[model samples]
Target: MLDISKLERRWLKYKIKKILPYTLLITTVTILGFTIPFVLSNRHSSKAMIPLKKDAIKVKAPNTENDEGAMVLEPSMHFIESMDTPSTPITNTPTSSTKPAPTPKHSIAPIASLPTPTPAIAQTQATKAPQPIVKGKLTSIKRDDTAFDIHEIEDRFKDTSNPNLGVYIAKYHYDHGNYSEAYNYALKTNSINNSIDDSWLIFAKALVKLGKEEQAKKTLQLYISNSNSQAAKNYLDTLDKGGSK
Candidate 1:
C-alpha cells in the first residue's frame, strides 16, 4: 500500500508540473494582449494632447516700388523727425554778371531814329549829279543863316569839286545834329584836302558823335603826327576824357 501511495504522488507531481507551464504561458499572453492595446491608446492620446507642431507663421518683406499686392509700410521715426525740422532758407546774392550793363555815354542812334537832315536834303541827295572841279566858297548859303538851303548846297557839292563846299556842308550838318551826314561830308572834304584844319575838326567831332571815338582818336593822332596841330591835340585830350566835342 505504501508503494502504491508513492506512485500516486509521483504521477500527481508530474501532472502539476506540466499544467503549471501551460497556465503561466496563457496568463502571460492575456496580460500582453490587454497591456499592448492600453499602451497604444495612451500613446495616441499623448500625441493628440502634445499639440502637433503647427506650420511656422510666414511673412513676406514689404516692397517700396509699385506693387498692388504689397503691404504699405508706415514711415519710420527718423523720417518723421526730418520732415518736422526747419531747413535753412536760400539767399541769392546779386553777382557781377547779374548787374545791368552800363549804358555808353555816346550811344549811336539807329538810322531810322536819326533826325531828318533837311526837307529837300533827302530829295536832292537821292539822284547824285556828276561832280566837276570848281573853286571858291558857297555864297548861296551864309554860315550865320539858320534857314540855309541844304538842297542848293547838295546840288553845288554834286556839281563842283570844291572842298570848301564839303566843309560848309559838314559844318552845317554838325550844327543841325546830323552827325552821319556831317561824317560823310567831312570824310569827302578830307579825301579832297587832308590839310584843311576845319575839315579834320569836323570829321573828328562827327566820329565821336557817331560813337566812333577810338577811330576819331586814331585819325587825330595820325593828323597830329603829320601836321603837329595844337587844336587836334586838344581834341584828342577831350576824347580821352569822354568829351564828345
Candidate 2:
C-alpha cells in the first residue's frame, strides 16, 4: 500500500509540472489580448483628438552645431503660431430708417408801385425857371439884335433868351486873361442858366483869379453838389491849395 501511494504521488507531481507551464502561457495570452485591444483603441482616440491640417507640410529648421559638433534641429513655436486660422463668415446687421427734417416755408409780400406825378404839377415845375441870385450890371442890360456886335455881346448876355452864348463869351474872356470881364459875363450867364456846369466852373475860376477865393470855393461846392463835375472838383482843389486859375 505504501509503494502504490508513492507511485501515485510521483505521477501527480509530473502532471502538475507539465500543466502549469501551459496554464501560465494561456493566462498571459488572454491578458495580452484584452490589454492590446484597449491600448490600440486609446491610441486611435488620442490620434483623433490631435488637429490635422490639410495644407500642413514638414518644415526643417536651420542646422545648429552643439558642443559635440553634432547638428541639431530645434522646433520653432513662432512658426507654428504664424499658421493661418479658419476664417469665420461676416454677417451685416440691419439698420433702422431715419426720417428727414421738414423744410420751413416763408411768406413773401408784393411791393406796391409808386404813383406817377400829374402833368399839371410838371407844367408848374417847368414854368418856375431858376433866376440868377448874383446881382451884377450885366443882369440889368437888355439884348438888341440890331446892335448885336462884339461890343454889344456883353450887353446881350443880360438877356435871358440865350445864356449858353454868354457862357461861351465868358470862357473866351477867361482864356484871354480878361478875368474882370469874364467874371461879369460868367455872373450873367449863371444868373440866366445856373444849370450850366461850364458857366459855374468859369465863374468860380474868374472869382479865384480876382482875389475872391472864398466866393470861388463856395460857388464850386454849390456847382459840385448840383452837377458832380470833375472840373469843378479840380478847381475846388486849386482853391483849397491857395492856387488861382
Candidate 3:
C-alpha cells in the first residue's frame, strides 16, 4: 500500500532540484574567484616581461670642461645613429682673383763736382767792397723833465675848489710815498664830497701807511657799509690778522 518505487522516484526528483541550484551557485563562485585572479596575475606577468618602446630623441650632455666635477651622460648608439649625416662636403671659392701690384723703383742722379777757384779769384771775391756802417746819434729821453711838478699842480688846485681835484692830488701823493700829504688831501676831499669812495679808500691806505692801523680799520669799515667794497673788506681782514696792508 505504500508504493515504495514511486515514493522513492519523487524523493530523488526533489533532492536533485534542491542540490542542483546549490551546486550551480558554488561552481559560479569558485570559477569567478579563481579565474579572475589567475587572469589578472597572468596579464601583470606578461606586461613585466615585455620591453617598452621609447622615442628616438637624442639627449646631449652638458659641456663639463668649465665644471670639473659635473657628471656627463654618454650618448647611446641608437641616439647617434638617429642624427642626420652630411651628404656632401662644403667648398668656399672667391668670385674674383686679385694679384698684388709691383712696387716702383726710383733712380737717383749722380752729383756734379765743382772746379776749384784760384787764390787771386777767391781774394777778389772776398774783397768785393765792404758796405759802409753809418753810426746813428743816440737821443737822450728825459722822463723826469717831462713830468709836471706836484708843487705846480698844488698851486693850480688852490684856485679851483674841485673835490675830484683833491682826490686826484691825494692819489698822486699816496703813489709818490707822501702819506701825510695824502692823508690831509684825502680828508679834505672826503669832507667836501662824502660820496667819493676813492677818497675814503686813499685816506684809509694813507692812515695804514702812517702806522695808524686802528684809525685805518675804522675808516675802511665805515666806507664798506655804503659801498660793499672788496678792497676795504680785504684790508679789514688783513688788519684782523695783524698783517700790514
Candidate 4:
C-alpha cells in the first residue's frame, strides 16, 4: 500500500505541472481583454471633458496608430440648435394660365381746322354801301384784259387817299377799252395826286377816245405848261394832227 500511494502522488504532481502554464496564459488574456477596453473607454471620456471653443462640436476621427476600430476626438464643425418652427421650402416652378394678357393700344385725336382771317381792306369795303357808278363800271370793264382780278383791285381802291391805288385803277380801265371809266378814274387820280404823269396822259387819251379831240389837246397843253412834261407835249401834238390814242 505504501508503494501505490507514492506512485499516485507523483502522477498528480506531474499533471498539475503540465496544466499550470496553459491556465495562467488563458487567465491573463481574459483579464487584459476586459481591462484594455475599460482603459480605452476612460481615455475617450477624458477627451470629451476637455474645453471646447464656442460654436464648436467634437467628432470622432480614425486613429491609424491604434486598433482598427479605435476613435479619437477632433473639432470638426459648428453646432447649431434646431429651430422651433420649420421654414417653408421655396419652389421655382412657374404658374400656368389659359390665356395671355393683351397689349395696350394708343389712340390719336384729330386736329381741328381754324378759319382764315379777313384782311383790313376787305373789312372796310364790306362796310361801305355800293355806289351806282362803281357798280356799273365794274360790270362794263373787260375782266380778261386786266392783269389782276377786278374785285382784288377794288379792295385796294377803298383807301381813296392812296394816290398809287388811284393810278392803278385808272391804268386798268384805260388798258381794257373802257374810255368813260378811264376818264373818270384818271380825273380822280389827278385830284388825289397831280404829280402822277400816267394819270395826266390817260385823262387826255380818254377825252380823244370819247370824240373830244379839242378838249384832249387843250388838257395836254395845260398839263405840259404846268409840269414841263415832254410826254404831255408829244400827246398834244398827236391830238393836233387828229391822231387817235
Q: What is the lDDT for 14 in model 1?
A: 96
Q: What is the C-alpha lDDT of each candidate?
A: 0.58, 0.52, 0.54, 0.51
Which candidate, 2 or 3, would have the higher TM-score against the true structure?
3
Off by over 4 Å in 1: 1-148
Q: Model 2 — which ten-residue stretch has the worst lDDT?
A: 88-97
Candidate 4 vs. true structure, TM-score: 0.39
Q: What does candidate 3 score on TM?
A: 0.40
Query: What is the TM-score of each predicted model, taking all chains together?
Result: 0.40, 0.36, 0.40, 0.39
CA RMSD (A), model 4: 54.7
Number of backbone clashes in candidate 3: 0
- Model 4 segments more than 4 A misplaced: 1-148
Q: Which pairs of residues collide in candidate 2?
A: none
Lowest lDDT block of 10, candidate 3: 105-114
Evaluate model 4: give its lDDT: 0.51
Instruction: Report how far off residue 84 is in candidate 4 (Å).
Output: 99
Give Cα distance to truth, residue 122, candidate 2, Å: 48
- Give me candidate 2's TM-score against the actual structure: 0.36
Clashes of each: 0, 0, 0, 0
* Candidate 1 C-alpha lDDT tens digits along 128-182: 2333323453212112222334556566676664666676677667756789998
| Total clashes in model 4, counting residue pairs 3 or more apart in sequence or in different chains | 0
